[model samples]
Target: MKTGIAHLPLHGGKAPSWLFQRMKRLAREITIAVVSEYGPQEMLRRLSDPFWFQAFGCVLGFDWHSSGVTTTTCGALKEGMKGLEVELGLFIAGGKGGTSRKTPSEIIRAGGHLSCDPEKLVYASRMSAKVDSSAVQDGYQLYHHAFIFTKSGDWAVVQQGMNDASKYARRYHWLGSRVANFVVEPHQAICCDSRGDTLNMVAVASEEARQSAVILSQLKPGVLVGEIKKIQHLHLPSRHHVDIRDIHPDRLYKIFVKTYEQAPENFESLLGMEGVGPKTIRALALISEIVYGKSPSFHDPVRYSFAHGGKDGHPYPVDREVYDRTIEIFRNALRQAKVGNNEKVDA
Candidate 1:
């Protein structure tokens, strides 16, 4: 495949199954090639073609093509975060967001530098920034991710925003003094579980926010719950493949009970409880799909490519055929890499 596929049009619809399958195969091959050649960070830096990654998003459901910089999905997370009443404590590293080349211990140390509270610090540190949402504004990147460390040392991810945030609500005032001008209710909070479970928080203030997420799934094929059976479907195509979204409460509760081999009583206990979060949800999502047939959306919601040129010199959708060819070229390049032949073949 040539690089011309990048020029194809991109509509918010599904491609033909045969084409979709070929795209999937090519995406995996290209991803492996990139990983073998440049490693994670270098690949991210070198790949200037957004169309290829965007097509990968269509296949993977998670947008592995770009960082979570100013996304509407992040906006959805923000709306969800605003609805909660807790002190929001976030944990992240600068290199985080879409790569996991760093070790767990390394990331934890970086988290320690950011905070004094061991709970918040540890929670923030253990959580990877792969799928964490962020926005670059005024020459700064605001990472919208958190670690909900429970009293038990468990954690979950929280994506923040208001349901229909107005200027006063979305706007955070930087008070001259140590304290800010506005007081946040419930104080976005995070806790952790000791059992190697990642429980993070994505705050949602209203049923509307939850419903909106469900709506996103309904409207877009790759936006909702991801597929089971395929491990790659867990997140968008990336180096580490660890971008897990904040799951719904009802869904979270269901997975926890089933996966741990817990009884119905234990399942009910997890629900109506606090701090059972994203890591837990991830565990559940994995278990449900692997053990059961249910699946979730893993398609990248950042549908349009960053490199997509608009008709009026703005960012808009590009040609479909061009996009496919572009993705194919990337995949072909990966095939030439010297990684594990079997692994490459599997991908």
Candidate 2:
């Protein structure tokens, strides 16, 4: 069902009791609708989208925080399942030094006890294949980060999200409940967890929405998957895509050396490396497709951009008056939440 005013004040942080009760009722209705309309796998498939998952996170609210989202993410794996009743979070450390510690290992530690093989718990950074790429940050720097984690735990982490704020991240909440309601949830399938770190070859959703993803993939190249059925020959878009195919090592090494020749400053260090980043990879992929018909998958890995038409598809420019009305509706609904005026105010 289309979300209503109740979905608001649910996500901005804390939820008031009255709102919580209302959400609980909504969640029940949603649960019944989902079970009646779709099978378990279909439900799981829908949750895979970061946007849908983030919406569920908003509904689940702070109660989700107590579960050590890290653990519930992968813990079910040790028991031969997908994930536990879990919540996904997306937070940004702003400020000059809005710092975040907890390396991959530390994050796993924070995720509570693991039942998997203890020896397999310790993981090393997976930056084996090294190549240099230029990133446009404050200053240009030759970046080289090869981080990886052991596959024997209840949580994972990644470096970025759909937005800079943590409040809008994604996870696989089953409706509004943390419960997975499955026999085996598939642990090895997740790409990133709570650690801001990732594992090797885990299939990640290359994009969200419909139109932009279709355009981006069409403009580039890749086997279409998930909701883009028009392209045919597609899959559910998961973590394994990263593992199956690899950039030809020989071609990559040569490209790196040549890059130094063309743009000497950027390519000097990346020569003969295994993992040449997305930019260099894109450059090589472009040349390969143009010159040799060997095109890498043209999926847009970024999550924030849209795929289909923007909100409601009005075809005309949005009216500012309507926009304010929408915001005011939510603001008022937030006011009606369960927490006191103060907590809700901060929320």
Candidate 3:
């Protein structure tokens, strides 16, 4: 599946309670309509599409361009889907901040209910987070993660990360059906506002770098620190743009110690370990490039815009009253159509 990307300026504040409640209702109605017509799996596929997800948030009456769209829309979906899992054959787990950490347990519970493999679902949840946070060093630190899945094990992930310095947020989308390699091109789309140099270990071009990093992981801590120092010395004079802040010797020492203790057999295992974050990942990639001449991918993976015109006149203003009325109309139509009643279409 092709990945979609959009740039969204970070906007603060919670979505108003009145608006959020309406959003939940509208989202539920829309989900019911979609599932009734296409099936649960199809709805999951659409949710995994960044463009469709952005549009879905717009139709539910959110600020089309605000970063709140990602959190609020997913929140609405989670609330709307409650108590309807059996009927819909789908589950949404995880949310912003602490809620995101609960995804594994939530997935396990949902999998048990659905008679699916809990272990596999849990692994997917963790790996998706790991790939985005460690493998793709795009400056944004992930804070929100939502995993959506169906009874048949088809899953999708909608997660957002924030770059505090830039005041921008990037959203990552994943579809299980499209993920051939979790470390390379795993995202169906990455939505962000700005594109710059990023250390993307998951890029197809970074295969050799990834391999080199794994090899580096097995080395002694002192050896890794020496390699990092050499890298720092070489780049310090010539490259002003390269940020060596992440190349701290102390941090590298700690990461190397952890690596030695864990003895990760592969790059994926190294990344999956605790304390192995973007800084460590970037350090290894740089070392790989410096020593082995295996350059990592620096290309930003963001594809295109997923946000609609904003309500506060960003690209254009959306009329709040009109937007609410539109939702009401759609919700009423879906109810009248008996969309979720499983009635005969011909009748």
Q: Rate the local accuracy (lDDT) of all candidates.
A: 0.30, 0.27, 0.78
Off by over 4 Å in 3: 188-193, 236-242, 304-347
Q: Judged by lDDT, which candidate is best? A: 3
Error of 2 at 111 (Å): 10
For model 2, residues 143-231, the per-residue Cα lDDT tens digits are 11111122223222222212233333322211112213111111222323333222211112211211122232333222221212221
Ranking by TM-score, best first?
3, 2, 1
Model 2: lDDT of residue 61:
29
Any residue pairs clashing in model 3, and if so which? 3-188, 4-189, 5-304, 6-191, 6-192, 7-192, 7-193
Candidate 3 global lDDT: 0.78
Better of 2 and 3 by lDDT: 3
Error of 2 at 344 (Å): 27
Tell me the tens digit of each residue's lDDT in model 3 across 169-238: 8888887888787887775555555676677788888899889998888888999898878776664433
